[model samples]
Target: MEYKYNKNEKTAYQKGYRVTKEGIVIGKKKNPVGWLHTNGYRRFKIRDHEGKNRNVGVHRLQAYQKYGEKLYQEGYMVRHLDNDCTNNHYDNIDIGTASQNAHDVESERRKERAIHASSFIKKHNHEEVKAFHEKYGSYKKTMEHFNISSKGTLSYILNKES
Candidate 1:
């Protein structure tokens, strides 16, 4: 995964078109490019050898500037340590395998799912579910009485109350 920069890119890098510690790309004049991709990563417009404008991720540029080509060798990618795509700060970035990056994203997704499930569960009457379970002394009967679809949901509601 070693990235070979074209002449234009190399020239830009040499001319002070560099990413800062904050993940902003600073041009030769020392002004921020201030452009961001829709996916939340900062982007820089660099002209290719063909003179066509191409967008590059600021994190990639930062990784290259900091760690050089060694970071990209053998399928390694730039990773956000805090799982924040927009936080391109030098200390918040790392070089890792695709699986490591995927694991970070998956961990974030699991947290989001848990938060959503917790909020959804709060919309239900936990006290009523607990009382009904106690009265029936059976999870199946309590779920049936509450019209709950998942036994796990019933268990969660009953257990969460305690």
Candidate 2:
């Protein structure tokens, strides 16, 4: 699944739009749109070489401005170094493969799972988990009984008080 480079979008960016280091896109008139996409990335409406309005991501635009068209031509995706979709700063973004992007997403998922486990642990102590485990008589059943999602979380809960 390779994505072809969008020359129209690139041309639109190069025509009169400028991206600040903070990821702000300024049009020809130097007006900031300050629009955000539903996925949290900065969005901009610009006219392409064909004079058609097009929506573009600030990260991609910044990457193009900083690294030129080679990235797009090579099928590399713009990735946020800090795994934040909203932080479009030029220095914080880079070009990477789709697999790398998927790894970044997995990293974010791990962080979310950790946060959820932490909150869950705070609400339910080790004694409760132990009692559930004893009644269930199996790790899988114990996890299901307590709504736990992973064996690592169950192990952590069981060992926290030891």
Candidate 3:
């Protein structure tokens, strides 16, 4: 889905921080110092140049300005495309249904599995998988012996490499 951003949004340079409409929080000469909130979103709390301490989620601040306050309506969630909540860039944030967010999470997990599988094969080779299977007698046990998940990825590696 196409994400929309406000072109008119300007970065606010408050006392020690610069907050962008895309939800980036930079501090102390434009350095990234965004902290993860307890709710798992990136946030910033600082005394703006005006000497007022402001604490808020970068996504909420941007979403409110980009999509408006009504964007907080029921059943809608702000999703990070990369699945890293700390990366609260405006382009990374999207308004999605709960199910859509869950689907994105699953997609990221699959990508992580592919990455892990490729790295493991690169480091150890497929013979290790074959040897584990021979010793354990089953694909599931082989996975346990190797300390990995994604049996499907393991099978693919075995087939393609062997």
For this target, which candidate reaches the highest TM-score against the unseen true structure? 2
Give lDDT tens digits, candidate 2, residues 1-162.
455556544775767787899978888888886587787887778777677888888888888888886666565788887789889888888888865765665655865665568566655566888888877779899888778876657766776654
Q: Could you give me the TM-score of model 3 versus the true structure?
A: 0.42
Number of the top lDDT candidate: 2
lDDT per residue for candidate 3 within 1-162, as digits (tens), equals: 233542122223324445575566666677776687788877766654456666666765565556763555666766777777777677777777865765666665766666677576555657877777777778788777676676656666666544
How does model 3 fare in lDDT? 0.63
For model 1, state the Cα shift of residue 111 in Å.
6.8
In model 3, the runs with Cα more than 4 Å from the true position are 1-18, 26-34, 38-40, 46-55, 108-162
lDDT of 1 by residue, 18-48 (tens): 8778778898788888577787887778776
Q: In model 2, which residue pairs have backbone atoms overlapping below 3 Å?
A: none
The 10-residue segment of model 2 with minimum total lDDT is 1-10
Quickly count the clashes in candidate 2. 0
What's the count of clashing pairs in each model shown? 0, 0, 3
Score candidate 1 by TM-score against the native.
0.59
Better of 2 and 3 by lDDT: 2
